[model samples]
Target: MCRSSQTRRACGRNDVVSTWDSLRLFSPAQYSSLPGRLMPSRPGELYPNAAHVVDYLADYEKRYDLPVQRGQRVDSVDRDGPVLRVGTDSGPWTARAVISATGTWTRPFLPAVPGRRDYRGRQLHTVQYRRPSEFAGQRVVVVGGGNSGAQIAADLAHARIDLIWVTQRPPRYLADDIDGRALFDAATARRRALDEGRTDAGGVASLGDIVAVPPVRAARDAGLLASRPMFARLNTTGVEWADGTRAEADTVIWCTGFRPALAHFAALRLRGTRGHIATVGTRAVDEPRLHLLGYGDWTGPASATLIGVGRPAREAARDIADFIRH
Candidate 1:
């Protein structure tokens, strides 16, 4: 954490800056080694970096002259080569073999709160949060338990703005604590172990370790961030806690993680527990011609990350080739 004693919000409005096109891209190397089973191994920068991978995919298509479609969001699948689809603006589109890489953000898990849809305090998900300067000098509340919430709180702490880091569960690591690297290293080790057959014992131990550390204390000590319980309701002024406590904020950031964006194929019987798509070793759904990139492991660390995506993509491609040959 950058410790400039002068409180960040103390900077006048003129000092605060906002960058709209704050998007970023990741290098192939980082993507190849992303640690979380379903996360894109993004290079940490001030801006979001997945756009780089999208660009790289486009470039790969051009280099190989592969017929890759860009900006075509698939709407539905059918025998006529997969039906209609759309653009980022929800325009129409279609395809035969469909692959969903949208990951968690597109369809976030909005909890069942009575008046949540009515509260208007600039509610936005971390996915929508490109940078912190937008909320400079304003009271902000962040809700989530994972890395996203931790990182955003840290960023805001640097800005000298009042921030409340809330989660249904409590915080674990310190705000200044950079302990995710340890988990990443452990996941990497587990991957190697599975490859070497050390714990091929049905991937029982391959699960990410469940470690919990006290939240508010570390965050408070590292930075002056506050923590609280699950949200019960929200109004124009602030959020109401389950215990009847209320926290005021100008903005509420839902960092409560993501859900797979596969509602287009909800009718298909391809999902496993919790509506997640089940795959037989990364090969496309039931039709092996198409393949799943970043899903939870059917077995192994296959579902946790972009690093997981690479192996599945390769394996699926090979399987397609074999199918073509036979």
Candidate 2:
């Protein structure tokens, strides 16, 4: 199976229902819509859990009668004459164009810090984190400054563990009233401004970094979400700050984020220096037949989120249809 499919299947399982504890949608359920269908309403849930999302997608698939082949692993995608050849474990299929929606979930990124290999403790990325109880009785250091880092730190704070959340810089919290809805609106405004050749008003980044979700808010209010500066290096016992401050930790969780999973497109050789395919909107600049979706802002503003991907997806479909017609 593809990496994204594997992620979805794993998430659907009871043991690992979501990527992490307190993992809820950043946006309201109303904004989580596909091209034609709206997400089924969940009463009183402005932010629903990951399992809710899994159920919604499963139901969407069945209700739409989508012909989705389960467990088919795609190995490569390359040009074959005038069409694109998709090599999968089951067989090869040719297509006039291809939409690569395999998201970055499989490609968890862990930054290389000095002495990382020498540290004698467990280290994992956010993708590997499930619940806080697993790290009970241990001194844990959570890294990164993004939402995942904040959420994971908050999840671990109330548990029976010694938690130290550290970021590269001071953590920035969005206003209490700001949520994914506001972030999405900002993104939309930014996109519109750029399209009209107006001065850029900035997107979600201008607001702040971490959204104060229920757990995060509670943690912050209780003074459990205080973050420290990033450590300089890892030693046998723990991490050391540049100022010689050291903290012993049994585990380090890196919430550094992810990269696009584009290994399947290696055969196309479309990746540029930044390790991303240059695109005009969703269509690859080098390979017009190739369209990427749900990667991130490069594909379209806020394209990586549940609520943000629909517009870009619709545009990509329209582009694909236009390509096929000509």
Candidate 3:
């Protein structure tokens, strides 16, 4: 969990479940409480919506009577005297230390395509997607292949509009290495094979058989939704594919995924692998006081799954708590 020679060796086993108290869990979801009734049905479903999270936090405060300020957006955090000074949108407060949990979702990753700002269609990120009804009767193109991408693509499949799923890479089995270019090509081939209702020549699995995520795989089974490669460019009127094909859509949901908001944390000398903060397990570069939870350490072996992240979180919290206790 704390990323040393010993911890790395121990992590080689898949069944290890570390104690929870050792980690500092900075769940950005805690910033907003949730209502009790909202639940996510699928693994990647956006459950415990922000409202639910906020409601839960309020209950937690009532139980433990913790002091939590709502509607306060934190501006800066710095060590000052015996406590850390956190400057928020409202005012400043102090803490013996801080756990920065502003999640990656707050920072949606958008591509810097040339004519993006000029597109007239309702271009929105998944973060803003409240419900599917907003997209009823609209042709929708969803981009990306990660959990969010897959879920959104599946959600918008039944709206009676032209639904095109585009991604630079394809989805692979949980254990696959997730190599980008190779995955994209593989996914593209799978889409075409599934559309034509034939087994892929290369033995790749078809998305058409999938039964979950709005059960749009039935469409693929029924030959409705056609998975395709990404568009080459975006114009106000429509999208231009690499093959020079054009399709107009009423809305484009960029479920492309998110990147860590390291810009706000630039002062920290973070070591990075793949443009993301690199970690030795959960520990940040050389800063033991800082740690990362959801970073993809390796694509598969030591992935950053929710289950994987828990171990590091517990370890970090324990280490930080001990230091503070002393």
For candidate 3, the per-residue lDDT at 97 reads 43
Clashes of each: 23, 0, 20
Better of 1 and 2 by TM-score: 2
lDDT of 3 by residue, 1-326 (tens): 11211111111123232211111111223211222322223244322233333334345446665454444556655556666566665667776544554445556778876567777898888776655677777788887765555555655654455688887754432322222223334544554565589875552233221213223334444555566887888889768887889998778888776775444344444537545665544555545555555444322112233323344456667867886788
Quick one: ranking by lDDT, best first? 2, 1, 3
Task: Give per-residue CA lDDT, model 1, range 30-89, as digits (tens).
Answer: 433432322234454322344444444444544556553333345443333433232233
- Give the Cα RMSD of candidate 1: 10.1
Per-residue lDDT tens digits of candidate 2, residues 251-287? Answer: 9999998888899989889999667999989999999
Q: Which structure is stronger by TM-score: 1 or 3?
A: 1
What is the number of residue pairs that collide in model 3? 20
Q: How well does candidate 1 match the true structure in TM-score terms? A: 0.65
lDDT of each: 0.53, 0.84, 0.51
Measured on C-alpha atoms, candidate 3 has an lDDT of 0.51
TM-score per prediction, in order, is 0.65, 0.94, 0.62
Error of 3 at 216 (Å): 4.6
Q: What is the C-alpha RMSD of each candidate to the true structure, in Å?
A: 10.1, 2.1, 13.1
